[model samples]
Target: TTGNISFRNETTFGGSGTVTYRWLVNNVQVATSTDLNYNFTVPTGATMPYMFTVKLEASNIVGCKTVQEKTVQFNPFPRALFNVVQARGCAPFNLQIGNQSTNADQYEWYLDGTLVSTLHSPNNIVLNDFDRTYTLRLLVKNQYGCIQDEQSVQVSTYPYLKAEFDVANDLSCNGILDVQITNRSVGATTYTWDYGDGSPVYVGNNPSHSYGRQGVFTLKLTASNGFCSDIFTKTVSVSNTPSASFTSNVRSGCNQLIVRFRNTSINATEYLWDFGDGAFSREENPEHQYAFANTAFTVKLTVVNQYGCRDEVSATNFIAVSPPPQANIEVAPARVIKVPNYSFTFKAVTTDDIILYRWDFGDGTSSDRSEVTHKYDRFGTYKVKLFITNRNNCTSVIEEEVI
Candidate 1:
């Protein structure tokens, strides 16, 4: 490195003709000229100050002379260097600059070609834009008001985050309320979930959860990437559980009853019926056959909804079936009776459970008795029919000929 120095002579010589000048540094003469001002260059020492004694002598053609002496010193040029704490970070980023300049007495800081600070070290610098880059420059000067060196660095900002999540509006199925969460955030590295069903908070990208009961609930998710955070919220719902109920067209009958069942289930998607006679059906509404007689049956219904919730109902002794009575007719006289003896007795020898009876003599006369005797006016043969009914409204008939 090198520096410049200048010397001036302010001397007066009387009676002078063609005055000459002599310039010397450290007692060594360097130039002998008539010039009053002299400019010189010298090497800058390593981390040390350099001092020189400058002398000037003036003489004319006469034997008259004048001399002046001065001491000069040269300081080293300043070198500017700095480092940025963070080159790139998320939005609203704080910037830190470390000043590593040498031999500087004054400092000037510039951001994006604009002077921001003149102190040796600036403080509290922050950048608030996303996906942008900025330039920072440092200018340093020595005590001589000489700005000789400059340093610059770049600071960049990362993109901001937009947090979002997606889930089904209705999470009910078969009866159970299960939810699936999807993270749809941009520029996020972590996630949090609040199911709002009095459950524990969840952490991760996507998760599966089940609610203890069915109703409406609030859902929330938060996404973060160490620079920014975002939140999403939604209202979700769950359906009710299934209830089982049923009805029948006829609850009781006799002799191979065929019953038609009607389903009245609520919030159900599937149904099962147990006829209690070793028969089952999976239809919503089913008709079952009861081929056995004199039997009482217990029916059951089971229902399930889309969320897999189930319910069941049982009807104890829901149906009753009875056997028909056996009908028989008997006459005191033989089947072949003589003319004018056309009187006969009819009897209901049916099952003892009989409740009522009917007799048709085939001669335009009738009787409503368990046993009856009737007479024919003509000598022709006649048919006598006997009908019997039991407690369960079951009927049977028998016929006999009389002459």
Candidate 2:
């Protein structure tokens, strides 16, 4: 601080005609010129409220001397001091500043090299730069412009963390459930996982796990950077296995056999049937026709679920089909028979095995034999019929006319 001092009155009391003026500060001479104004500067590194004495002496050739003295007080310099509650924390760090400066009349605060506040003790200072440092400064000045001081501190911050992940295989079937995980997180250094299946918690990234049973489960992942953490969750579903089974109305029949199949499968969503006769079907319950005679055929069934798990069953030689006997009638002794005592021989012929034969004459007489001789009482024209049955109870008939 500096100031100018002057002896205002130019006239000296009881002095000689010509006067010499001398100025002294703190008992040391600074100027001896006739100019009354003196420029005074406080010494460097002077404390606040510094006091000094300014004196002036008037002397002439007559040897008369007079002295005038005055004391001066300067304004105090301000001391700027402060403390922060916390200097380092996670992102969006909150700060509580305490102002403990002395002899200060004005205050200025700067954050990250930008002036932000002028209050002596500002509240609610928040910093949002992640993983970086900033400078917080405080400047204080006295009321009279004597001096000003400033203090600064370094504010540090940690990074903001996020947790993210994905399930590669969330679905399974056939009583087997296996899961795969993928990590896709940002600003994270550590990881934790929970499969939510009554198992131990896992600690790592991208882990594979298997469940013992079929059901739905929840999955959780936590990511951390040692100072902050985040959490993410998901759900998974599993299904049961499939079993194939079926039943038929009949196993064996004559030619042109028709069969009805009934399906009884567990945990099956789809069905396929192979009738072993160069035929196939996809219906759950189906009816089939077998046309090959005197032949046996096998049947098979396959079932599948939504998860692409499948099971198959086959019944070998499950159906038997038989051919009916084709009957032929032959009458001997000529086409015309004599009246009274006319005897005609009847014969039945077939390629298949015959269990029984029946013969019906036009004269109301019938016989149950492969060949028979019949005598008609009276007949102008007559029709003879033959019926043959195979071992499978399948029958065929033929008729012939005689005169």
Best TM-score among the predictions, by candidate number: 2
Pairs clashing within candidate 2: none
lDDT per residue for candidate 1 within 44-141, as digits (tens), equals 44443466788898887886888888887766679999898778877777777788898898888888888888877777567778889999888888
Q: Which residue window of length 10 is worst by lDDT in model 1? A: 40-49
TM-scores for the candidates: 0.45, 0.49
How far in Å is the alpha carbon of 76 misplaced in model 1?
A: 64
In order, what is each prediction's RMSD in angstroms?
Answer: 20.8, 17.7
- List, residue by residue over 1-403, the lDDT tens digit for candidate 2: 6777666646456633888888888998978875557666778888867788978888877878888888887776788999998888877788789999988989999998798889889886788878889899999998778668999999888876778988887777656677878899899999999888889999987888998777778889989998877899988767776889999999888889999999999988899999999999999999999999889898999999876668899999999998877877767877687767688888886677898888878778899999888877775788888888888877777899888
- Candidate-wise lDDT, in order: 0.80, 0.84
The list of candidate 2 runs beyond 4 A from truth reads 1-174, 180-203, 216-240, 335-341, 362-364
